[model samples]
Target: MTNNTPRVALVTGGSGGIGRTVVERLARDGMAVGVHYAGNKARAEETVAAVQALGGRAVAVSGDVADEHAMSDAFDTVEREFGGLDVVVNTAGIMLLSPIATLDLDDLDRMHRTNIRGTFVVSQQAARRVRRGGAIINFSTSVTRLQFPAYGAYAASKGAVEAMTLILARELRGKDITVNAVAPGPTATELFLDGKDQAAIDTLAKAAPLERLGTPEDVAESVAFLAGPARWVNGQVLYTNGGVA
Candidate 1:
């Protein structure tokens, strides 16, 4: 509220691939950033260090995004350290592939807890704290539309996110906060490609119209636009797939 800088923002899952890229881009854009992580202390710290190295203000805060109290504390830390809140980018998600018939309840629950519940907790917190003209950006995936085999659970989880974002934007009608979701195509992160053979990866590459995997940075740019300048784009799901689906 005192400088040319717009406002502070928080990026959940800040230690992971897409999340880390989002934190860096937002920080570079002159917003104080809170990098939230779950159990990846070293990586989160490294993310903070990298942002600092780039002359950006940032800090790492650890908490499970699914827990209400923990998410509350995360925002408390962000407001306390960075002055106040303005934007939120939720990139925390888990993807476990399994046939619906063979899917373990435990795996299903974990994905829901982190991807669906986590998104709710964090978005709720953002709704309460972010200032007027602030933004809330949630992560979805192009997989929901692609409907690839063995990705039912993952797609379902992101589907929940898309639903949440749509309603939250309508619910916040008079508040000046724009809520939206970004669904990226297959990205070249360890999490996205782990355990896949070269042949499998090559097949996936061919599936995309671009004939390659997406990079975390590619997705981050979309996030940056939603959080910074795309104020009118509320209550929409922007799928950043290379015309795949």
Candidate 2:
């Protein structure tokens, strides 16, 4: 079900790696995108500019996905400017890797706030507000299936996302709104490469079946599929991991 009437889409963390790709792709697909960011106005504006350069409508909105007030405000901005929402992509998340025994409670709490609570808060709003045939997409990570050593905390949080997505789909069974998540493996994003060295990066890059790390555009392709068309798919956690886990 392709749309040309300019559907509105809100992509949280729109300035980030996969988020930016999702924003750009949805915009190109004829959706008026909401480039949402927590504190990066310049980057968000750049995403919006790129979308505009592609002959699409986009606007940058600021909000904390964990905060209801902020999320509602961002949604209001989208509705006011583009009319109403048809798609919402919850892509705002944080990853702090540490052995479970060495994990900091503060870091764990912070990750939980953004990855779990934030996804829930924004999804709740999407459940109530998205148009009849809209899509509510969430973000997860492939580490949940890989069971990587230092990723326990992050994976735990995304596990919550996996569970919430399935239940949310059942809860919204009559609404025609599909709730789903895309879990990508190691991607070539700043967030995914923050502390790695050259050799380390090369080793990790070749760990996947495809012999290279995933790309933001690769993950965005799965998200875009679930967001538009793919109406029969719901509550699925599609792992776009290059067959790595």
Candidate 3:
């Protein structure tokens, strides 16, 4: 956090919809970025290329977010490449929806492995490695509050994330590191749009006071604030849902 040296950020799931925007936003904030992808090497590379196109420094690192060793290596790569780590953003997640009465336990387990365990793994590394003045941002969802049917499993996982974010922030006290979660509502991303009918999307969009789906850029702005100047905003969930409770 010195004056001359630039900050470094590693964004997990950086190849996807919101993750890609987070990468670009952090890079635009003058932080060298590590774009982490799970399986999409080409998309990850394209993100890196886009960052480079903007004349920003970036590298692509791949790993399963739930794998401890892979994430450790990823942290190492980002730190080694950029000289140090200042921000870690966990954006890699999966959502499979079903009513709790008939939900597949297999689906629940799979989603938990990625959303819950994945946040923990990445967070453990960030807690251990991120420099002072750093921030760790995890993704949650406003559905935890809205309690929409069929999102029980997803909400449960993100509820765990909100809990972890507060606990991690308290644990990092005096370290000057902030831990928080960004819970976005009805963002217009492939993940949210996939398999959703137009009526369903419109209903959710109008549920917010903004009366429209949130753009990835809208969420990225919240992230950029947390990563840069929101020093006092710790151990909290900032709902980037356009006033949707």
Candidate 4:
């Protein structure tokens, strides 16, 4: 028998960018949401309020994705506030771009700490706490396949996400949970636009066969599918790029 209760979701880094759009899309799909943010409490609250303004249920929860205790508490808050978790979208990550040769070790370490370790930590909690028939969607980047020059460290971190995501799907064989990763190409978000001049932006916009940069809404559509339906699409790294790779 199908359950009548509304599914709930916890989106890490949901305060901004793709994460924010993901939260909005999930809420529109009739799920209560926990918007998790690392540092910006106010920003997360804004996302929650926006959802509420649209007659959706949402709550802002804060935590550093890399901190086990913190993430555990965030999950606890979501389960407690929303009744239970039906989906987890680990969108919390950092990107520091530089050619491999001159890349700062500290930057690499910081990026990995959030992008790799953070994904693992969040996925672990989702595995333990998310109810059966739920979904776990992790974020990846097309740069792993695109082989962009300065994205070595960033792509390495995402490559790890892809590997663990596939293994985690198999590991949860009997749980009725689907684990997948969404790898998006360049999207038109504030975070992606930051520091990029118009020329560079234009160049990337034309890189895809679509001849334009992707919008957050474009990426969120794929996430909404993985979170709610598309049950047969499991253990895969879905390249949500518009033919960029």
Write down the RMSD of all candidates, one decimal each: 1.2, 1.5, 0.8, 1.0
Deviation of model 2 at 1, angstroms:
12
State the displacement of the C-alpha of residue 222, model 1, in Å, after optimal TM-score superposition: 0.3
What digit string (tens of lDDT, one per residue) describes model 1 on residues 1-245? 44474589999998879999999899888888999999989999999999999888998998999999999999999999977899999998888899999999899999999999999999999999998889999999998999899999999999999999999999998999999999998889988788999999998888877898888888999999998889889999999977788
- Compared with the true structure, what per-residue lDDT tens digits does model 4 show for residues 1-245? 15898899999999999999999999999999999999999999999999999999999998889899999999999999989999999999999999999999999999999999999999999999888899999999999989999999999999999999999999999999999999999999888999999999999999999999999999999999999888999999989889999
TM-score of each: 0.97, 0.96, 0.98, 0.98
In terms of lDDT, the poorest run of 10 residues in model 2 is 1-10
Off by over 4 Å in 2: 1-4
Residue 231, candidate 4: Cα error in Å is 0.5
For model 4, what is the C-alpha lDDT against the true structure?
Answer: 0.94
The segments of candidate 3 whose C-alpha lies over 4 angstroms from its true place after superposition are none
Better model by TM-score: candidate 1 vs candidate 3: 3
Prediction 1 global C-alpha lDDT: 0.91
Question: Which residue pairs clash within candidate 1?
Answer: none
Candidate 3 C-alpha lDDT tens digits along 1-245 = 68678999999999979999999999998999999999999999999999999999999999999999999999999989999999999999999899999999999999999999999999999999999999999999999999989999999999999999899999998999999999998889887788889999989889888799899999999999999999999999999999988
Q: Compose the digit string of candidate 2's lDDT tens values, residues 1-245.
A: 34556788999999878999999988878889999999989999999999999889999999889999999999999999998999999999999889999999999999999999999999999998999889999999999998989999999999999999999999998888999999999899987788889898898788887889899999998988998888999989999989888
lDDT of 3: 0.94
lDDT scores for all predictions? 0.91, 0.92, 0.94, 0.94
